[model samples]
Target: MCLNLPQMQSRLLLISPGQSYRLAPYLKAAERLGVSLTIVSDSRYSLTREVADGIQGDFTEPSALLDAIIAQAQTTPFSGVVASDDSTVELAARIATRLGLPTNSIASATLSHRKDLARRQLQAAGLPVPEHWQLDLAREIAPQLQGLPYPVVLKPVSLSASRGVIRANDPDEAAQACRTIARIIAPLSNPIERQTLLIECYLPGQEVALEGLLQQGVFTPLALFDKPDPLTGPYFEETYYITPSRLPDAIQQRIRQTVADACRIYGLHQGPVHAELRIDGNQVWILEIASRTIGGECSRSLDAVLARPLEEYVLAAAMGNPLPVERRSGASGVLMIPIPRAGVLRRINGVQEIRTLPHITDIRISMESGQVVETLPEASSYLGFIYSTADTPQAAEQALRNAHRALDITIDPLLNS
Candidate 1:
């Protein structure tokens, strides 16, 4: 559905990492909305034809990035600013705030981006969050790990997509996990993120993801996804996400309410919200909340139910003309194809076979053959994404599983390993 915005000539500035998978979809959405879009990233994009107005600025340096955006605004002012991913959301918020555009405050974005800060804010607000501890990486981790709860999950403060997240069963494991996480986050340029790690008591339950939009501090849930695959992990690498969730209606409402409360606590008043939570019996535990649409190609799953691409809503919200949140009947899902091992990909077999399966919509193999792939705690990208749709959530989830089973991924062990 093409959204007929009042500002038909509006230009949206999309801030994202150069390698983000979200850029193409958002660009397509912008075109569908009949709006001009500019690309802003730290690296150059090959889509020079689609993105005529591109700005390359280091995301690590906010002062320089903001200056560049302000300079660009003088010539071609953006009607709205949107962040395509978690890494760029805070900066997007900062840009929006600077330009006096509709956006959540920078503090809200920061709280959402930093796990440690989010936990503190949520706890202070009396929200159900796992007991967590922040460890100063500059000091000895072993001393910090002492007397902490066992079976805790340790992760870097700001890395998303479960990168550098590990579950430790005991003190020894916690110490080793911290060391491993340190190495995983070593390449990050942010001093605070590089120097701090969060260890939180692992909450065991069925996990779910909420995709919603916020307007004037009110959150409207777009989709509630059931993570059929158990996230009880030594490392939390998410796989399956099926929606309209199979959970009871009342429980689902509580999950939504929890997310809304979290948004209120963070003072998030506008744009898309992607929240992850754990349902432990009757208790709803907020795992993490991000001020962005659901990550990766997973957003495509919503098209089956929304009757339009999720990016349309996101773009509409960014442009300060949020379309009504509505869902048509049916269920959909996406499998974030997980990398099985650390190695160079040799070949992926059975794409044809998977496509033949019932309800299988698409199979995207993102990692090219011969490209090196890493598993969780260090892995950043998925092998690819598998999308499906059916009359029921079960059928949708089964379709994803069936598709995954049909494929045989072969990875050649790294020479060093």
Candidate 2:
């Protein structure tokens, strides 16, 4: 089946903050769907000569960007407006509303980005959320730390990819973590984004990621990923994602129901939802939910199992087209190569050896040699992604583990820079 949508409009506007691996796939999906896309970006570095219809705008200033989009729409009306990642979600939501395109509301987008607000909304809806306190970065944080439970997590309100997320074991460590995280937040150009941090009691359990879609307030699950590695942390760095989840049927249903409930609580009626949850036996807690698909190259695992590209489904959803929710057969997994140290990347060895392993479908090393690499608690990207598939979840996971062990990575000191 081609997954063709004849009713979708021919033109679209994509708002992306920079050049990312995400752009090429979306462009390919648009081409396959016979849709013309106009790239709207804040940075021109990632825009290539191939993108003939491109616009540069101030992404941080939504009102000005909306005007620019409106002017462009007058010349060529858009069938849909979509954002590639979290940074552009709000802008895309606003543009879509003005153009009468399908999208989540601005309030939904805001809740998706702000952790504190999302937590409050969920808690009020009688949902299970961690006990959390919001600390204003602009004022003294010392007074706010009193009487809170030990072993809390300190993280910036809006940052993603686990950047600036730290675990503090005590009051003293929490204070230091707050100061460190605030310093990380201080240089951000968005002042409103820089002013708050969330202090929440750290839940102890295995983590899982849910990838699904919503259409007119109805939920359709796509895949559920199991994070085999324990994410308990001083700094939580996610490395592995294996799916066709190994959890029992009851647990999986609960996870799905909880995430769907969260969507309703936040008023997110449409688009892809990438959610993080913590589970200990039957008790499940929602960590974070975004109006986007799985982040990074991890989405590749789903692509390997699906008949159509994941981007194609996302694009179809944005156009208000019905998508087949069923996934292709088999167990697939992805390993996000974690950076061991903060330094300059020198070189990666054993790529051929890793690829030759049984059941190893593909491997991509995203960071080039000589690029400065930073690890978790400070950085937002990964070194590369490894993909694998097999008849069983254990076999698929083992294949990824074997492939990961075959390579050697070298990182030079920051002084070399």
Candidate 3:
């Protein structure tokens, strides 16, 4: 979408690490538009390669991060500000609000980032949210868990990518899960405290991920990704995301409607909205929603529809420009390479063999040898991402499975173990 804004120097300020899995496509989009971008990040992006100026800082400190962004803006104002992940979304909202840019309200951003707040708001809106409780680390969680049903999900209030999200089948399991989550979040410093967590009755149904944009509190559905692997989990490590949904059109529309209502309830009036929803018969339960696109390499599934990258749409929307929405015509999918165990990555073999799969488009191993890799309930990073597109959603999904089967990842025990 192109906007009819007054002609002036346009530069976007992105709040994300350069190495972020979500940055490359957006960088490509900005490059195509010749839009200069400045980044506020903790690390450098290889994709930028000195092309984009970067400011180093702790993104977790919202106030300090906003101050840095404000200081930079005084010298060279930004046309828009955007976040690269769940951690930065709040900061981006603050920056956009401070700059008087078009974006969702800070309150909305807060609700979107914090699971506890999101559940409260949705419940108040009369939306279907699982029965849950907000437990403060300062108190005894066991007493609070007395009446709540088992097979509940215990999660960090603001963590993303399923980090610290654990499903407990009983009281004993719930207690252990809480302790495990506390340990996982202990070292992180953020506005939301590690002591705060949400435990909700686990909803049973097939899960689907919705990626779209919200304009004036209305939702424009872009893609709906079907999670082929059942997420019925002790731990949810997302794998395949196949789009051009296999769900019936009626069911898909219902999903969109539910999500649109959710955006309104959350007060998300603009920018990208990535939502996870579950379906069981006629019931549609929203698991969670983010005021951003789908995270990780999963987002690549929706890129370059109608010759425009997904980031292009996001940028246009941020500037309040009217870029026409276009989605890729056929089926597309991405397999987020899940970490199999907690160990030091030793080597990755058989990339050449994986590439031999007919539908494989790209194979990227994100983690390097020597780096420690851990799976869900403690980790956010994926081992890598595999991309595939086919004439049908089933074929694309199968290709991802086939390609994954061909790779051999070697992880050695920790040095001290």
Candidate 4:
């Protein structure tokens, strides 16, 4: 979709700063459209938050933060609010609604960010989705699950990037795994036992994502990407996303149609969308959907591969401006560097060699020398990303993975510190 011409000057308030974690694309998209950006608050642990301007109160407290932002926004006349992480997307929607601006419905935001809620909602809508259930931390394991199967996925309902997400082979294993998940959030919430849990029937097949723009609950599939690594069971950390997913045309159509129905069923409005689908046979299961934008280095992939200005689409939509319907053509992919353990930053190898590949467009390493990096203490652990675009999807896909494997990483722990 082509964004209508810019009607007026627009200034946007970015809720969180960008990085490899998530929402980096949202910030980059705003930059592409030349939208004036003021950092609202920082949620990550990096030193980057100091670069942000408005760091008032706290972000987790939705009401307090909302009031502060609205109070300040009235004077600044911030055109809109945006959040890129699953942790705060709903809050972003709430702030927009509170300000009487065009925003996604909070109920919709809740459905998208919380996996268990989304699955149930989609099931009600009769959309294809994974079989999942809510695991109350304080409740006993389901009695029927004693004879159940293994490899079931257990995760936090509202968490993303695989945070607190794990898999169990049997009910006994499931009970132990639930204990570990329960411990991770104790400091973050009181009576954390009430935290939402998801035990899902693990669906196997090639994992693919649909990147697009959703206008008034209508989903427009822009590009399809494939996940090379097996995302089932265990952790959900993504490794590579190569666009022009190798799926046949028929399968691609089915994926798009299924995702479109999901966006509508979940109340997605005008904005960027990131969707995950697992296909086995003719069955297509909707994994998750993000209302704000795609996480990881996907925006970079679309930029380098599709050769389009995605930031513009996000900026225009957030400002109530028309989104650019047509995107530049080309195939693109992004490789996310995975973490094996936590320790001090050391060194990276093979980037220079990988960059030598003809299809490789650019390579970025977010980890700094001497900086501490760890395996997803909770699943969002990625050091950096590799981006590439080419004439053919195969070439782009091959070049990205080959380049990624060729790259090396070295980490030395700062044990005493």
Q: How does each model score on TM-score?
A: 0.96, 0.95, 0.93, 0.88
Q: In candidate 4, what residue range of length 10 has the lowest lDDT sum?
A: 1-10
- Better model by lDDT: candidate 2 vs candidate 3: 2
- Give per-residue lDDT, candidate 3, residue 188: 66
Residue 290 miss distance in model 4 (angstroms): 1.5
- For candidate 4, write residues 294-377 as lDDT tens digits: 764557787754445666666777787766566666778888878767788788888788778888888888778888776753
* TM-score between model 2 and native: 0.95
Candidate 4 at 221: error in angstroms? 1.7
Ranking by TM-score: 1, 2, 3, 4
Against the true structure, candidate 1 reaches a TM-score of 0.96
How high is the CA lDDT of each candidate model?
0.87, 0.85, 0.82, 0.72
Candidate 2 has its poorest 10 consecutive residues by lDDT at 1-10
Residues 188-287 of candidate 2 have per-residue lDDT tens digits of 7778778888989999989999998888999888889999999888999998899988999999999999999999999998888999999987899999
- lDDT by residue for model 3 (1-417), tens: 222333335788887865777777777778887778887786543555465777776665567766766777777777888888887788788777777777888899988888899999999989988888887776887887677778899999888888888998988888888889889878868635578989998988889999888777768888888998998889887888888788888999999999999999888998888999988877889889998888746767776234477788887777667488765577889999888889999999989888878888889899899998987888878898998888899999999999888889899878683
Question: How would you encode candidate 1's per-residue C-alpha lDDT over 1-417 as one tens digit per residue?
Answer: 112224323888888888788888888888898888888888855463356567887888889888777776776777888888888888998888877677888899998899999999999989999998999989987889999878999999898899999999999999889899999988888889998999999999999999998887888999999998888889998999999999999999999999999999999988889999999999999988999888758898898999678898888878878887778898999999999999999999999888888999999999899998999889988999999999999999999998999989999898963
Worst 10 residues of 3 by lDDT: 1-10
Question: In candidate 4, residue 44 scores what lDDT?
Answer: 45
Cα lDDT of model 3 overall?
0.82
